[model samples]
Target: MSTFTENAPGVAEQSPEAAAGFTLNHSMLRVKDPERSLHFYTHVFGMRLLRKLDFPEMQFTLYFLTRLLPEDSVPEDPDERTVWTFSQRGLLELTHNWGTEDDPDFAYHNGNDAPQGFGHICFSVPNLESATTWFEDMGVEFVKRPGTGKMPNIAFVKDPDGYWIEIVQPDLTAGLGR
Candidate 1:
């Protein structure tokens, strides 16, 4: 089977509704431990908690995080925060199903294995060498150290959840100026 969508000439050509404004909203990951994921994202990666929603009956909670501007602040009110969080782009959503972290055998397939699907998330730094050094200083685990991968200037590291996060230095690794 194909992974892409097939389109009919007329219906898939274009439409007014399809042309509406679009934003690359947020990407969600199922985290085993909320505390660990939260710490990694907030302290290590420097993302702010935009909002959190808990469902007691469903036994799960959702955490919305994003890297906001220095001047931007999340509202204290729940409604306002939800509205604001969804309105922005480039957000990360961490979903925690209660008790998953406590299970000794539970593991979410990271999709880079034999079945191969979701590969990794990435962050671009101003300088690859400096960033990789900083990650080392912080005791972060490395899947592929800087200057060692197929893309030598780029690096890949594993998070607490065993999810791969690729790091690149724009203008050096990816050939795009930051």
Candidate 2:
């Protein structure tokens, strides 16, 4: 393994002063079919649709979804829900460009192909075995299965748009023998 030298060049600074009020809000991905994408995310991954905004002028729509814990309370009012959704973390934003679903060849690069870029989004399930079994029963495609890969405790599933979603159990990963 290579260690960082004293004068090692950096792409970004490691200064907290430059990021005072910063927090990771969400990550966005473009989907070809909004309906299929929404169904896959909601039913398969168990994410709730927090908010959706349609822009007729731009010919696009934005769908924001998040995993709401059992103890979390969602506000009833639209204004309150909007504020609460934005203030929370681990949100997933899906962008649908209007008319793309009509084009049979329309597909977004999943960023894990030849020229790899963005890899995947992950979810930490309470039980790895049960979660993977549930995913298998739902007919979800798997890129990597737990106990088959170098990291036995982690698995990867593909969404409708072919984007990878890594699944792991927090307790199991601690004993990976790293």
Instruction: List lDDT for all candidates, in order.
Output: 0.84, 0.89
Model 2 C-alpha RMSD vs. true structure (Å) is 4.6
| Local accuracy of candidate 2 as per-residue lDDT tens digits, 7-82 | 4477343445666667677899999999999999999888999988889999999999998889999999888988
lDDT of 1 by residue, 97-138 (tens): 999999989988887877999999888878888888888987
lDDT of 2: 0.89
Where in model 2 is the C-alpha error above 4 Å?
1-15, 175-177
The superposed Cα distance between candidate 1 and the true structure at residue 55, in angstroms, equals 1.0
Give the clash total for candidate 1: 0
- Residue-level lDDT for 63 in candidate 1: 97
lDDT of 1: 0.84
Model 2 pairs in collision: none
TM-score of model 2 vs. true structure: 0.87
